[model samples]
Target: MTIEQMKRNARDKIINEIAFLAGGLTSACQVRAIICAYLYVDLVSDAEYREYCDLILQVENKRISQSDF
Candidate 1:
């Protein structure tokens, strides 16, 4: 799959897992760590992986915000 596809798939997987695992109460650090575990340490470059994690973090944070209300 292309990078965009990978990113989308990763986002979906992470969000779903986080929602189910913690009922949308997970922290940013836990999200970041989960991203690292999913992205693969050696295959994906550090900078690119960080960018992907950042993107996912934004989405996850939005979920957290919505859940608060």
Candidate 2:
């Protein structure tokens, strides 16, 4: 695969795993925290980084359901 495709695949795999592990309310919060820690660096593009941050925010804020993943 191309470099960009590989990056997307990696991102998708991590996100999907996080979403899967967030099956309950408590686990959902934990997932948010884990994702925050995992993304502590500022290497990726602003928009790409914000997408994941926003997703966790929605989960933490109960604006979206974990099953939506």
The CA lDDT of each predicted structure is: 0.66, 0.58
For lDDT, the strongest prediction is 1
Worst 10 residues of 2 by lDDT: 35-44
lDDT of 2 by residue, 1-69 (tens): 776775666577557755664444345556555455445643345576578667766655563454467
lDDT of model 1 at residue 40?
78
- Where is model 2 more than 4 Å wrong at Cα? 25-43, 63-69
**lDDT by residue for model 1 over 1-69, one digit each (tens)?**
877677667777666755643455566667667677766734345775777566666667677688799
Using all chains and alpha carbons, the TM-scores for the candidates as numbered come to: 0.43, 0.48
Report the CA-based lDDT of candidate 2 relative to the real structure: 0.58
- Residue pairs in collision within model 2: none
**CA RMSD per model (angstroms):** 5.3, 5.6
